[model samples]
Target: MAPPQPKAAAKAPAAPKSRVKKAKLGKARNYDLGNGIVRFSKTKMFHKTAKYKFVGKKNPKAPKTKKATIAVKPIGGEKNGGTRTVLLRRRKSFYPTQDKIKTHRHHKCFRKHERNIRPNLTVGTVCILLAGRHAGKRVVLVGVLPSGLLLVTGPFAFNSCPLRRIPQRYVIGTSTKIDLSDFKLPAHLNDAYFKKNKKSAKRSVKRKEGEDIFATKKEKYVPSEQRKTDQKLVDEAVIKAVGKREDKKVLRGYLKAAFGLRSSQFPHRLRF
Candidate 1:
């Protein structure tokens, strides 16, 4: 403490770093070899081989293009002492003229007209109708009509739906199927058979001399006898087929029940 500390030695300054000069990169150059030929060098001093020579001749002159000129005629002759150029008007056509003739070839259709039925849908399969007058009603699939429409029935006893045609796109195929292999469909059960007969013009009944038109009774509409017989025949066959199965009661109840979705029911998650 008593001895005064010697002055600290001054710190020596750091030596400066040596600056290095970067080498300049060389550029390629072209060397003329006479007779319209030239060779390119790989670098400023490195020349390529003779095989790398290219022709350096001037390009040939392009041919002159023809200019379109408009046809003009002098009007009023020379009597007026002045010439007025009038351009010839071209004949205008409503339809465009085609330079090339095209043959009338029939258009080829690439679309498929016939629809593929779902693997789950088959004859005698119980399906839920999704659209049309009988939507939500479960009906039995009879057979596919020639027009690609599905023929179905409610046996006319359970849901009151008679033999009718429905498009396959409007039905949801279920897992339930009835055995109708042994059952034969009547020959008249087809698309044409379902067509309604055109009704004749109704003739006005000769009203009594003072009869009131408002008091006249109207005729109630009734199904044709042929239709009733057809429905009975189809329903009998279906009921007979149902009777053959052990779960006939359950199947009948299922067909009679209407299809519906609950709050938690998701159609996509449903198997059928």
Candidate 2:
């Protein structure tokens, strides 16, 4: 019998594809507006890489010693006697990726800095801290920062309420207030604003003082500026006081009093 035809040679396996490594991505923080709209904080990203190499100077092909239509002397750092030549090339230009073109994005809005904010909570509003060392403690709302952080103060005479920024979600608003109406709010207030406040007198009507109503010269240096160290000490003390409390029973009691809730009350944090 005729020998069986040798089986067709097995086709060589196709070469495996080289996988391109995915670029590392940076995490972006998200914020929620009162409405359904959500805001993504500015992303930390490197600018796009240059697209094309920089254009080089055009020079005559022929050497200057040979003499040509163009100047024989090199315009740039080319051959010293003949046509000009480029020494160090310039940086390449930036080019965008195909993916970037598919999805166009605006980086930052002009209105990002201009806030038309009218927050419901104000300075001196009684708040229940729901997070951090000051969590479950009573704190007087300090002021709404431009960045929308609730700058709060525990005044930590007893509670460990570090003067810190609690996310809006962790702050529980209550009907209590510390009568800060007499206090003047500042433009773009921060934790330091509280320090200046402590050093100055409240904005109460000035009474007759020795019947001498003379123009008080405004000192170039205010005494309040010097109390930064003291303010920092207070902040540290408040944070320490809150962190040291393990039982937190007193803290819970304070929370209950601020919210006016009973043992059976299943009160949840108020969200706006």
lDDT: which candidate is best? Answer: 1
User: Model-by-model lDDT, in order?
Assistant: 0.80, 0.56
Clashing pairs in model 1?
none
The C-alpha RMSD of each candidate to the native structure, in angstroms, is 36.1, 27.6
> What does candidate 2's lDDT look like per residue over 1-272, in tens digits?
99999899999999999999999986434546758455643332111222233336565687548433343345555555556544354545876565444656655575466543335576667687777755666776756776557877666454545456767888767665445554443443464454343444433344466754553433354535434554455445433444455744654356334334557766654341
Best by TM-score: 1
My TM-score estimates for the predictions, one after another, are: 0.53, 0.35
Error of 1 at 222 (Å): 2.5
Q: Candidate 2 regions off by >4 Å? A: 1-104, 109-119, 185-264, 268-272
lDDT tens digits by residue: candidate 1, 1-272: 59998999999998999899999977535757788455643443343434334446567899999654455454675686455544355555676666777887344443435667777889999999999888899999988877778989997799988888988889999989999887787888877888865764343565787887745444556788988998888889899999999999998898898999999999999986
